[model samples]
Target chain A: MNTSDAFHRYTKKVCGQIRWKKAHDIVSREIENHLHDQRDAYMAQGDTESVAEEKALLQMGDAVSVGMALDQTHRPSPQWAMIGLVMLLSGIGAIIQFCYYDNALAAAPAGNISIARFAFALPLGILLFAAAYFLDFSFIGKYPYLLPVALLGIDIVAQLIGVDFNGKNWLSIGRFAISPISLSLPFPLAFCGLLYHFRHKRNGYLLGGLFAAFFCVQLVCFHTMSGLFVFVCAAGSLMLFAAVRGCFPGNTKRLFLLFVVAGIVLFAMFLWANSYYAYRMNTLFAVFRPETDPQNVGYFPLLLRNIMEHSVFWGKGNPLEIADYSAILYSGNFRADFLLTFLSYEYGWGIAMFLVLLLTGFLAFGLHKAFRQKSILGQMVSLSILCTFAGEVFVYILNNLGYPLIAPIALPFLSYGTTALLLHMALAGILLSTFRTGEVFRDKELLTFLKPPLFQWDNGKLIISFKG
Target chain B: MTMDKTLLAGSTAMLILKLLDGQDMYGYQMIAELAKRSDDTFHLKAGTLYPLLHGLEKKKLLESYEKQTDSARIRKYYRLTPKGKKHLHEKTEEWEVFSHAIHQVLKGGLCCEHI
Candidate 1:
């Protein structure tokens, strides 16, 4: 039986009262079905078709009232606890700069510019975060190709004409040099969009792998092993998750095994091909034997180890009577790379442990929220964001503890880099956005209907049907 | 005999939960079952039922899934979650205590005819 015009008008009116567009389709469909069932029942009781529909419409009660109720329940609520944690972390980062590094920064000519730049970057980073938080993240899926292509194009342009900063190409953005390599930070998000786009196609995983290779190459070309490591971990996990979730078009287990094997082989090849990476690995192993080479590669680690060894748990460690105190303070990128060491040396190891635990707890909470999402896209996006943040913290802590496996990536909100600060803020925005709208974002392409089982017993068969 | 709308309104969520405790049910089916079980005393509006159901779902107290009925009509069915079941048990206990108190106060060992 066809639904009458009156039924359509009623549902439309009800949907109009719902402020959230995402909830409209679901609410409309459920209401439509309820109306149909009522109309059918009335018609069975000898009512005319028109009369039944009219009665059904009337019995549903006021459309506006129902819509208003649904609107109240359907609206996306911000994750206040997560937001508070983010703000707290960002504040700690700012405090680290102004309190510990301020005098050191003021003493140098470029430090004045750095401090001014940090002052400029803080609120600007918060604004970028706000913008990202309020943004409709569904646009990532809608224009899957455009985002990656644009980011890659920017990187290419930056490489060709950008200023060289510390042996890496950086786009000069008016007194602020932005690392084009950091542009790869959102590759996991872009990759998710591409996965959604190619969900129905054959060898889509291959395309995803190829896309990852391209970004990984960009990170490699820039010699940012930390960025490369982070991108691979975040984006690689996203791909693996998409496959496990059956968002791709092949045998899931086979694809999973293939990914694992490919990852191992490529990683081996990468390590073998790069002598610098090999040296970094060798240095990582040398961490335990820092005393053996105390004057060369182990100089800083040994210095750090000695300070930590002497440092008390709660208060200031023994007075700094070292002859090379200036050398320790003026180490390369001391504010960003060795801030944790300085923090521990001055304030005590307790604070350092607390900071690490706080960061770990925050990331764990984020991952938990991400896993609870009903939408695969939200899960993938959240995983990437959390992975990047967690990976940075892990590397920072490891390097701080005298392990120096790779150069220290910024410790997310606590580090003193404008670019990194801005990136963290923006990523926080995306993470908050995912948590805010996580439930309502159903990837339409991924809504697969499973065929019910057909049973046969003694030549009698029961066939189950599924319709899209 | 129809109950007061206010009384029915207060108990609608509990009644719905009780009805679904036995089996998963669609919106229309729940409404019909409520009326039948209440001997036509309950007349739940579709408008009220859906919003209530959705609110419960948002709280993770209920979960909904779509499946085709035997009659070839696609129906969205609601199932009570573990949380919802726990809630129902608590509500039932609270209701029993309140109703028993009301009964004792109203009777007071005196017949209505004497009054």
Candidate 2:
């Protein structure tokens, strides 16, 4: 078959495979409309019926290429990256808190794991998916502004009544320990809404400012080194967005002066925020001095050694085996070793290398798309996701290699946590949205749709019907 | 044309409500009727029409049913709920007031320019 005929067949096959009903219909109609136009052109040129049909198919191009182009429309956005980063970081933070701070073996805190399981992970996952599907709907989209406000208001009211549900504190309601942060899953969702609004509005600068403000607020609330690291990563991602968009303020001198002033202010705030900074600084120093607090500082090193000695290549079936081996080998406490130790013990070096290559590929592809897309919204969204992952992967590696400054951040898709899962899904959704809206796909579809009679409305209505 | 575009988009819910107000019609019939009424000025694209229809259905403004047509093809037909009529009435009033104000402004501007 000719390339065009092959392309047409590919398009039909791929369009049939699209899972989302709306997306599938949109793509199928577009392809059919293009094919119809080609047929009409061939007929107008005085070709015989069969010859016109064959020529039309040939001119329309390859189906797989067209299908691939159409498929890009559903790729996720930078918000997904930000979500993944936060979720992974938060999951790692929770794990760290549990292993080191919470005394996990001490009676298990009277319904802690159950609350973590049912309240946090399960409900949050469901809520994230629901929000993703409903984001574009009018009723859902129109009043989504109220969601974050309502969540924040409810959290405040609950707090006033001495009820805590954020998983920070355990509250017993009959048989269960209910956490409110379970409901706060929608806050990140609010960020997604905000991102979409700003993206459509073409307000990249505002998006960056909002991201910075949100990161600062998170840092203040968490008051941990990991939180600050995430904040920095978020800021860096936003800056990358700004730089990509060329939306930086025009007055370079003034902007520089403003940055200098801001830097000074931040430095002063850092000094004022001594407790948090001091804790981070101490931890950083402790990385070098493994004996400083062996339970905390030397824990990962001992665990890594045990994993290496016992089974350097696929050490154990259970990830927790590293902890068991460390306790026995170094007479150290059983804390969750950082992700690197978990990797070495559980999967082996091959898996780790594979994961690195996969992550590198994802980041490279994401960055390439970001740089190529002209739309500031698309570019910023893509870049933000790439930077967030880059920062996350870097920090995770640093933490594992005896730099033990911050808690481990989960690798996207691989780590277990409601926050991570939701975040990845959100990022994927955003990228998909961007890919759908990209200029190349837009132009091709626009050309097909703009043909005479197609663009002509029948008294303010579209002429075609998919059902027919 | 602009007025029609606004009316069509703004009154999409109203159009669906009005169409369903009388009797049930599948998406194809609804589009054909919409085109015929508008004198072929607004031909509804399936992409645009279906989403709006589905959105309205989801909001319970319209109810849909699947039945075998005479041609033996299963067709989904939509009919207006009472809630949809109420919504349409509210939207119609809003649109009338909005369009009247717009018309007055444009007419006044033309008269002033003539003077």
Candidate 3:
């Protein structure tokens, strides 16, 4: 047989069985290169091309066994602990939804219509998560433009003529009332993968920043007010990711310019548009002086404070009923925002604090895991996802605690929105696929970090130990 | 002495880690170096080496970065991380104990009549 044929057979046997098909190309190249080197060495020792090739192929040993070994080595290992934690939170979310639904039906007469958005969320989340976890995430980078282009097209069209909900902020699809926000959620993720993949090329970051800025502009003009904050944070993260990776050589100026432009536009739009967005800023007053606006926007902050103060270490009280989603929903009550409040009331402060720790630990471990990725694109996407997650969680918790710099960006798995929950699970799946090859955290640091130190000696041993 | 194929495959990771503790090396460089250093005994194959290298990286025992040569070929170089260095030390210690025991058995020091 020809050298090419032998080489092809060798690689096919080696990489064909691997689940992460994206790694196959690199695996084949490395093997082919090795074979060529061995063949060249034999040729130097007075062997003909075909003879050298045969000898080289012979030295590789059995193709089937080698392939199997490789398959075993590169097989993806799911981070089950992290997956379990996310599932636990989602379980609590489901229970919360059930509880709210029960109470809402009891409060209403009888014929109130229940929103089925969350009914499909769990099943859809499972499907999307499984698909993302099983498939190679590198495909996102491979066909990057497909998702971003489609989303932009949809968003632009939605902005132009799509049916509006509640004074032109949210765009809903025909008949089924599918929110355009849900459709646009996956674009940032795919865009970051492409950016990381193309960071080395000329005009890469500039072009990426330009597209991103244009997208941000579209989001701004489209007035996806609730989604606009998430878009800003996600897009900002991608830019920061590019800057840190330094993938775009000498294009920092253009990126910075785009950031400033988008920043100004988003800030101005927030000020000009949504009153609820404006109401969130009044949260600082609620924290410091609760009596200032006792009747208005100060109610949530003061209510949260009261809940914390009256709350036991383990909650013995009933779950707090906050947002009356019944007016909007046809049937069940919408507990859309108030995640932390619900956690404290239902599971108690103990479980709530424990979950807070879990969230922090999970994201920290994810960020650490991303650095260990051998693939630059994996690292980039991982960082982008982690940053977006971190930003949302931080803002969400802070907003709950009375420093509401951002509006109610819902908690990841615990939030009530169908689209938010589905997107969250899918992001987790992508994160899993990225860190599938790497250790989630190193050297038992998580346990140590979570555990209170045995020693409290401030003389020399124990410094500041952080509580979750 | 000839070794079992499974045994050779098993030792490749430790052998690669052992080689890498001294210096960083790329794929082809590693193959050549291992052959040269082992006097062609271990005979590390390239097909197995890349996957093994990648596995080690995933375990956080190694880190890699790419550099371009004057000839413009991108070369991926692997080095022992701090975690990897600590792991290598432990592996070396284990190997020393295991090999010493094996040597004792081979040198007619152990009684295997029961077996």
Candidate 4:
């Protein structure tokens, strides 16, 4: 073989052993550079070019053996620890549901359906998680609007033919009913991609803002205020983050101020127009001082306070004996919204604290790893998921503690509902999928063209210059 | 003089990490530096060194970056990561204990009286 082509031939052979094709170019380049350096060093010691090349080629050893060694280390790295944690959380959810059914079923036989539903949902959620975990999440970046648009389309259809439960619309097929609110949870993740796709374009924020507004209007139309709140909070934070990171065209601080003022004024007007919402806001305030509305809106808060106060640290606490009120406390709603309080009441504050700590630990671990990722798409998508979990857990804790600031959102994996469970598992899968391929996957579309360095040093004097 | 393959293989990663503990170096530079520092007792081949460096990087013990040298040649330099430094520290301690034991055994004297 010719001397120059010999090095190329060696690199090709070495890279052929590496099964992951993406790593081939990188491995090839490094090996080829080393060969060239070796050749140059030999030539510097007075060998002819051809002799130097021969010596350098011999120094690299067997191509196949080197490649085999490299192949072992260059394989795809899956986050097994994170995967175990996710499954652990899912298992905890099942145990909590089992506890609820075992305790409350004799009192309310209707609780049997929930147990049956849980059986069905758990497998389906796992199946979806598996699917999402293997899924290349970059498609969200490729088609940024696909998830949000599909969700909106589903919601629209649900509004037309879906079943209504307590005035909120849910898409139902057979025994499984998919809450539109749960469907809306992925909006922020999709928005991350949407923002990324338009980050470099002029007037991209305008298009992005309209897309968010459309989703908000749909949620408001369906009267899913909790979903609307989540969608806005998560999407708003993403937009603000993008703006601050110079993803948007305008001044980030000014745009953020404008959005805050606009949101407050609109929210106030809505409250002024809607007395029911206004009353709910007042009830939020009156929760701490339950004596003001003891017979009415403050009733639940007072009961919650009484239950928490009476609960012990480790074992079962004294059950409230207010007749029908206690019966209501043992219903399915208690399993979904007041899970922490229910657990505290039945088990103890210790178990509740354990659950809280476990959830916090998982979220903190995810946030730390996600933030460490260099890819922008991975960071943005993970931020959205982490924010959703943090927001839900925060709201759930407040509502359970008797504040009732907003309608209680499910505590992610811990809450009891088929669609909610399925959605959360799917989201978790996406998160794990991101962590799995984060190091290798790059969103070429989102990558900005780096300008040449504008600052340089000449003769040890620092020079700064501007670039056009 | 050739060292035992297994012995060389076991210590190759430790030697490479120790070299990088001083400063970042390209593949060829590491090979040359190892020979010089070990007084020609260690002669790491390009094949062995590159794979070992890549393996260390995969474990996050090392990180690589490219920089243009004075000759305008872009060289891929590998440096010890914080994790790698900690790993090297542990390996160094283990090696000292192991070599000391071997020395005592070879001399027919137990410097460490426990065994």
Q: Can you write out model 2's per-residue Cα lDDT over A1-468, one digit (the tens) per residue?
A: 533344346456756544444455445544554455445556778986567666655554455544454454433233455345445544544553444333232333233333345345544654664465334422223354665566455545544553333324333444343333223223333443344344323444455345545534544443334445554555545554453344554445644553455456446545655656766676667777767676775655545554544444544533345445545432212233254555555557555556666667667766765675534445545555556567666766665555656655445544433345566555544554454444222212223333334233543765643322
* Reference-based TM-score, model 1: 0.87
Please report, as a residue range, the 10-residue window in candidate 3 chain A with the lowest summed lDDT. Answer: A438-447
State how far residue A7 of model 1 sits from its true place (Å).
3.0
Structural similarity to truth (TM-score) of each candidate = 0.87, 0.47, 0.76, 0.79
* Model 4 chain A: lowest-lDDT 10 consecutive positions: A444-453
Ranking by DockQ: 1, 4, 3, 2
Candidate 3 structure quality by residue, lDDT tens digits, B1-115: 8867796665677889988987998877888898899797767766577768888986889887655455334456889999998988888898888877887799687644334
Candidate 1: stretches off by over 4 Å:
A1-4, A41-48, A100-113, A320-322, A329-332, A446-468, B22-24, B36-40, B63-77, B106-115
Q: On residues A1-468, what C-alpha lDDT tens digit does candidate 1 reach at each position?
A: 345457768889999998988777677767888998999899999998788998999899999998998888998878889888888989998987776555453323233335667788899998998898988777767788987887777777878878776667777667776655455566666666786676657877777777777666666775477777777778778877878788777686769765976587558646754767766765765787888777777777777677677677888777656768546644445756877777787788898888888898899999889997877778877888898887778778877877776676688888766677888899889888988987777666423322223432322645433332
Model 2 alpha-carbon drift over 4 Å, by segment: A1-211, A222-224, A265-269, A276-279, A291-311, A314-325, A328-337, A436-468, B1-115
Q: Is the docking of candidate 1 incorrect, acceptable, medium or high quality?
A: medium
Error of 2 at A120 (Å): 11
In model 4, which runs have C-alpha deviations exceeding 4 angstroms? A1-12, A20-61, A98-114, A200-214, A236-277, A445-468, B1-8, B22-43, B63-79, B93-115
lDDT of each: 0.77, 0.51, 0.66, 0.77
DockQ for candidate 4? 0.43
Better-scoring candidate (lDDT), 3 or 4: 4
TM-score of 3: 0.76
iRMSD for each candidate structure, in the order shown: 3.0, 12.5, 9.9, 3.8
Candidate 3 local lDDT, residue B3: 62
A1-468: candidate 4 lDDT, tens digit per residue = 655479989999998898977668567767877887889899999998799998998999999999998898887568788888878889999888876754343222123346667787799899999999988877778898788777778888888987776676777677666766567677778777887888757877776776666666666676466666777778777777777667767776657764775476447545643558768766876787887988888888887777888689989887676776577667876767888888888889898899899889888989998876646788788888887777778878888887776776688888766677888999999988888776655556322222224675754866564641
- The Cα error of candidate 3 at residue A255, in Å, is 6.3
Best by DockQ: 1
How much TM-score does chain B earn in each model?
0.88, 0.85, 0.88, 0.91
